[model samples]
Target: MFCRDSESFALFLFSTDPRLIQTATQSGVGGVVVDWESIGKAERQVGFDTQINHDTVEDLARVRAATRARVLCRLNAFGPTTQAEIEAAIDNGADELLLPMVRSANEVETVLAWVNGRCDLGILIETEAAVERSGELARLPISRVYVGLHDLAIERKTANPFQAIADGTVERLRAAFEVPFGFAGLTLPDRGFPIPCRLLMAEMARLRCDFTFLRRSFHRDTFNLDLRYAIARIRRAMREAFARSTAELEVEHRRLLEAIATADGYFRARCEMNRTDAVQAASQ
Candidate 1:
C-alpha cells in the first residue's frame, strides 16, 4: 500500500457508505486512506478558517468492522483544528496519517512531534520548497511522499495546469523513478488522457511504489467498470514489467545451475582423497 509497506490493494475511501469497505474487502483491496474532511461537514465560515463537523467516530467504527485492511488518515492541511483532527484519527486506530500541503522539512518535523509516535507519516509535497527537499522527506519517518500534482503545477510555472503536469519535475522523477511512491494528483476524468496517467503509473511500479490514489473524475464516480478499466491498464503495465524481471531472474538461475555442476567434479575428487585418508587411518 502507499502509506503501508505490506502487500495488498490500496483503496482510498471518501464515501460514507459502510458497505464500501465491505465491497473493497470482497474485491481483495488491502488498505484505505480516508480523507477526514470528506466525512466531515463544511465550516460555517467562507474563508480558510473552516470547521468540519461530522460523525467521524461512527464512520470509523463501521470502517473498522468491515476489514483488516491497513487504515490511514488524510487530515485537514491547515487551521486551528488540524492537530485535533489528526489526534482524533490516531485515536481511531489509523495506522498512518498524511499531512497535506507541507512546504518545509521543519513543518514535517513539527507534525512528527505532534504525532508523537502515534502513527506513521506521509507528506504531500506541494510547494517549490517541498519539491526541493523531497529527498530529505523520503529519509524521514514518512512512509510515502505524495506529490500533489495540482498544487505543484500551479505553484510552479507552466503554460497550463495540465501542461505543468506534463512538463514538470514530477514527470522527470517518473521517468527515472525510485522507491517511495508519488500520487497522480487531481487528474479528473474530464481532463482526458494524453496527460500521462499511464506513464505516471508505469514510473510508480518501476520505482517500486506500492500504490497511488485515484481521485474521482466525476461525482458519483464509484469504482465501477470505467475505474476498473483504468486500473487494468496500469496493472497490465506492471505485470509486463514483472515478467521482464522474472525472465532476467531465470537467466541468472541457469548460470548458477551451470556453475554448481562445474563445481561438483572438484567436490567429488576432494571426497575421494578424504576417503583414502580414512582408509589409511583404519589400517594404522
Candidate 2:
C-alpha cells in the first residue's frame, strides 16, 4: 500500500512495449501508471494524445509477470462504462485503481461501492468543484489523491498549471487528508520546466509528498542516462532537499512562492489582453 512518509516514490507511465515496463521496473520506480483514462475517446477528443494511446491489458499482464514494481491502473472518470473498465483493469492485474476528474464525494462513494476493497483506490483532483469540495472528498476512504495539473489549470484558466503548488491549494488538501497526496508531475534534472525539476522535487519533499508521476519529460531528458541511475539521482536529491535546515528550506520556499506569483501575473495579463482584443474585434 502507498503510504505518506518522508521517503518519496516515483511512478512512471506504463507503455504497451514490454521493454518499457521492464526498464521502468529495473529503473527503481515505485510503480507504473497504466493510463486507460487518457486513451479514452473523451480524453482524446480533448486533445490528450501521446505516443502510446491504446489499452494495455495484455501489456499490463506482462508487466506484472516481468516486474516486482506495483501496477496502478488509471480508469476513466465515472461514466457509462466505468464499471466495465474497472472490472477489466482488475482482471488484468491492477494493484490499484486511479479514477480521474472526480467531482464529488458521491462519486467517490459510488466508486468505493464498486471497488469494495478489491484494490487500493486513488482519485485525481482536477476541477474547481473538486477543490472546493476537497474537504468532503478527503473524508472518503481512499488511498491517495493526486492533483492533476493539466486539467486543473485548464479548469481554472490559470497561466501556470503548477500555481496550485505555490498558491497553498495543495497545502489545504494536505491538512484535510490523512492519506498520501501529491501534486505536479516530475521530469529529469536537465529538463528546465516552468518550475525547475530540482526545485519541484525539493518542494515536494518539503511538503512530504509520498509520490509523483514521472512524465514524458523524464524519458526525453534521461535518454542517455541509465534509467535506474536517473531515478536514484532524483530520489537522492529529494532526500537531501528534505534534510536541509529549516532556514534554508524557508528561503527556497519564499523564492518558489515569488516565482509562482510572477507566472500567475503573466498569465492574468495575457488573458486580459486576449479579452480586450476580442472586445475590439466585436465592436469593429
Candidate 3:
C-alpha cells in the first residue's frame, strides 16, 4: 500500500505528536509511521545506537485524525499478541500495519490470514534468517517491505550496518521483492555525519528505491528552515540523481563504500578503546 509510486519516492515520518505529524504531512511528508515495535529491542540493543519509541494505539488514532495522508503502525514482531495488535491498529485507523523482525514466511502468512485484507500488510527484513528466507517471504502477497538497518546491524553483528548497502546485502534484499520497497533513512541531502545524505540518495536512486524513512535528524539538521523548501530540495536532487549515467552511479557507489569503511573503522576503533578503558578501570 505504501511506496507504490515508481516515478518518485515517498518519505515516511516516525513520530507520535499529532501536531508535529500534521505539520510534516502538510509540508510534503508522504506518510505518518507510529512505531510500537519495542518488544525486546532494549534487550537486543543494550549498548548500541537504538531508538525504542513508545507510541500507542491511541496515539495512532490521534495521528490518524490529524492527517489525510497514509498512517502506518509498526507492530511488535509477529507473536502471540499480533492479532490483537493488528485488530487494534485497524480499528484505530491504521491504513497499514508494518511487521518487524520477521524470520519466516509462516509468520507473515499467519498475519495475512488474520488481517483478512482488512488493511495492507508490510514487513521488515532486519534479521539474518529473514535475509536467507527473503525469496520465500517476497513471494507472499505482502503489501510492501522495508529493509531495516538497525535490527539488521545487531543481527549481523557488524559495527556499521550501512556496510550492508556497500557489500550487496541491501541489493540482495532489494532484488527479492517486486512490491513497493525501501530501506535506510534520510535527513537533509547536504547533511549526515560520516556518510553524507547526498551519497545515500544517489544509492537509492541507483537502486530505484520506492521510498525511505525521514530520519529524526532531518528536522534537527535542517530545523528553522522552511519544510516545503527542504523537501523540494531533496526531491530535486533525487530527480537529478535518477538521470545519472552508469559511470556516475558507479563513482557514487565507490564514494559510499569509502564512507562506510571509514565510519566502520572508526567505530571499531572506538569500541576497542572503550573495552580497554573498561579493563583498565576494573584493574584499578
Q: Model 3, range 110-222, lDDT digits (tens) per residue?
A: 99999999999999999999999998998899988899987898788876768789789998888778888888898888898778999998888778788889887886877
Q: Which stretches of candidate 3 lie over 4 Å from their true place?
A: 1-7, 269-284
> Sort by TM-score, best first: what order?
3, 2, 1
Best by lDDT, which number? Answer: 3
1-284 per-residue lDDT for model 1 (tens digits): 22222233243544445566556545444466666643322321111112243437656656666667777677766557777877788778788888877777777887888999988988776677777776666556776666765455446542133333334466454333244566663233233233333344334444445566655542234435454444444345445533445355355434433443454455446435655665687699
Question: Model-by-model lDDT, in order?
Answer: 0.54, 0.74, 0.84
RMSD of 2: 4.9
Which pairs clash in the backbone of model 1? 189-217
Residue 234, candidate 1: alpha-carbon lDDT: 38
User: What range of 10 consecutive residues in model 3 has the weakest lDDT sum?
Assistant: 1-10
TM-score of 2: 0.84
Native-referenced Cα lDDT, model 3:
0.84
**What is candidate 1's local distance difference test score?**
0.54
lDDT of 2: 0.74
